[model samples]
Target: MITVRCFAQIREILGCDTRELLPAHTPQCAADLLKVIAGARTADLPKPLLVAINCEHASLTSPVKDGDEVAFFPPVSGG
Candidate 1:
């Protein structure tokens, strides 16, 4: 199983802060994880979404395995 956490606008969009998915329900990459979490709303997700694995920044294609913690959020901007 994997733990998925959504923050900021992402959490609002998905209507949940965290979820747990079995490996069979999700593929092996961060991209696939996003698809599973977003489902049909995938297209409505923010463009250029940021991803992280176990607290380290990662790309959409980053490999994921059981027990990994994945986080998704929109890019942040501050002055």
Candidate 2:
């Protein structure tokens, strides 16, 4: 089971922090998974989401395996 975690804007819109036991198909990559969570709407995904897999920074194309932890969050900026 894949673990999906949403943060910040993504979390607020989805109204959840984590989703568990995702099927090991369809969305085989981090970006595709986020698109699925965003209801397949490109606009909903916005841009430049910070993603991590198994606690390490990863690209949108990173493959996800069963039991892998996938996390998503918007970019952060400080002045």
**Using lDDT as the measure, which candidate wins?**
1
Q: lDDT of each structure? A: 0.90, 0.80
lDDT digits (tens) for residues 1-79 of candidate 1: 8999999988998998999988864449998889889999888888889999999989899999999999999997869
lDDT (0-100) at residue 12 of candidate 1? 94
How do the residues 30-61 of candidate 2 rate in per-residue lDDT, one tens digit apiece? 87777767764547655787899999989889
Q: Which candidate is the best by TM-score?
A: 1
How much lDDT does candidate 1 score? 0.90
Residue 74's lDDT within candidate 1 is: 93
lDDT, candidate 2, equals 0.80
Error of 1 at 8 (Å): 0.8
TM for every model, in the order presented, reads: 0.89, 0.79
